[model samples]
Target: MTNAGPDGRRIEEALTGGNMEPVVRIDDTVRRVAGPWTPAVHALLDTLVRGGVPEVPSPIGIDDQGREILTYLPGTVLDDVPPETRWSDSILQQTGGLLRRMHDASTSLIGGGRHVRTWRSASHEPVEVVCHNDFAPYNLLVTADRLSGVIDFDFASPGPRIRDLAYLAYRMAPFAEDALDDSGFTAGEREARLERLIAAYGVPFESSEVLRVGADRLLELADFTDARAVETGRTDLPEHAAMYRRDAVLLVGLSSPQH
Candidate 1:
């Protein structure tokens, strides 16, 4: 495939975790196909940067091709790393802390009409903060065992703080079935890591609450994925939905009192 853009700049690489939009890197900038939600996400990023939250990408103007441009963060995204590396204790703790910083920074947007702005993802009630709805390892940038940056705000929307935390716990704590790929830990490790993550966030939350919320989040995501598959004609997404459902069941079981 040709790696040159219409402007003749050499495309450095095609980024992953862009399930809906095409993303590419050029020089010190990354470009992604923009949607109606682009403006809101850019505004959120700008607000976070102005507020001294240093871990997210800086939004540049849109390109001639109608793509949103962002200053490239120089670190390896967790998706490109080995499974064991993605499951490290330091990574889990760092991600939890970074998420706390992001949520805290994003709370500033709640009162500014930013909470009701257009987003690709649906907003939930009690909008305490802007949730990076997909806070999984795939969207995290790591350097020297630290979560140095976060990317891909396409799914962000206004929601409760624990909404983001729950999704993060589901993916990082990984309450998925063992048959799936990248199911990094044994069932016994889920609660421990979940507790560790919540502790790092420095919040008072029950692990069971997180698990229950995580299950609900997964069901919502499954429906979203199924709809996207139908809209985009991506044959593989139904399987992705199935996996989400399976994981949701696991989380529900884990959250139950008998367990």
Candidate 2:
């Protein structure tokens, strides 16, 4: 793995999120393999950075290798920290509040076009705001005492707030089969934890809506990825369809309004 580029910079292969989304580190910057739509996505990120939004890995520029350059944020992404991070109250609150701020900035920007390509959205969904579409623990960088930053802007697109919140709640609140490697809270505890996060994020929602969001997104994402894999002959998510179904059932079973 060599990263000898024009900057005379040596790059190191990063341990990706269990996928082949080749990422590399060069000093404090990250270089990611980019698609044609990356230019537009980078522009959106640039806007957020200029607005002084913290916790976002602001885009720097495109490298000569055509990889998108991003300022690598320093902190352990939540998945790395595991059970302790997930169980923290302040971590949840900060994550939710950061998301709210992101949505506020995104609503004023206009960037999605029909020609732009993204796995999360086939056509530009009508926007209440551009959603991070893949907001989750793995994408969130954190310290023991603070929420540091977010990485991976690849799945961002124009969509509803709940569409984003639902997924966030699902993964962050962890309404799934093996959340925190199955060492996490019970159903009753998770339900209460989710309420605290939503209240912290300040989104209005019926308990039913939150539950529905997480479950629906799990299946919807699986379908979208499977469709892409078949259409392009790319193996996007071979195991996830089944995993999504299982999680959807898990969520559906626990649709009770209270902990």
Candidate 3:
């Protein structure tokens, strides 16, 4: 691909890879190609545009080559943290509110949206809106410990609210020894932070019903990951599946007050 833009300055700064397409950061824009998940992503962007989601970037339309262009959101994504920074209650609370807002806006688009897999369970009913399936810290932009924006909606789809929440908790919780490697904190500390986050989101943290449903949804995610890995012939994904199982065990164990 050519590196020069209309102004003759170097446009490509970085490239984020995916199974479907490549995400290139150029000057002040992000260009994404039509990947396997393109239809789902386009559906999500359409919903966000119609709903007027404030923090998400507005899609500028597709190029002649069918690549999507979006305004670049400024801020650092919290994929990795420096040792000095701590995961505090306030940050967790903000994240909860952000998630709630996104879920609320997504209701209208729930069943109409498209994506990789359908997230359905007996407890959590499906809703219609764009779901950012990978709404983890890595995809979120933060400034001064506050959520500024989000990116990389490659896995966005229509699904249940709890499905998204379960994924978020799975990624955010420090249930294993290696969990703190990225967050720079201990498992206990991260659990406490996650508890505060759940409470802040107005989710019933103490309800047996909620816990049961969340656990089931989490297991569903594990099954999905394992199945996808096997189908795609990814040899390395079984390790992830094993880690998730271990993590699930630790999560259940820690949920008991006696633990």
**All models: lDDT?**
0.84, 0.74, 0.63
Candidate 2 ranges beyond 4 A from true positions = 1-9, 18-20, 110-120, 123-126, 180-183, 225-236, 256-259
RMSD of 3: 4.7
- How would you encode candidate 3's per-residue C-alpha lDDT over 169-213 as one tens digit per residue? 655653433456756766567666667667766766552333444
Which model scores highest in lDDT?
1
Write one digit per residue (lDDT tens) for candidate 1, span 107-216.
Answer: 87887653557887788998888998888777888786777888899889999989999988877876655323575566778679889999998898999899889889
Give the alpha carbon lDDT tens digit for every residue of 112-200 in model 2.
55444344344345567767777887788777768888878787787777777877878776775556455367766777878987897
Most TM-score-accurate candidate: 1
Q: Which ten residues in a row have the lowest lDDT in candidate 2?
A: 115-124
lDDT of 3: 0.63
User: What local lDDT does model 3 show for residue 209?
Assistant: 32
Where does the lowest 10-residue lDDT sum fall in candidate 1?
A: 176-185
Candidate 1 residue-wise lDDT at 136: 79
TM-score of each: 0.91, 0.84, 0.74
Report the Cα lDDT for residue 163, model 2: 79
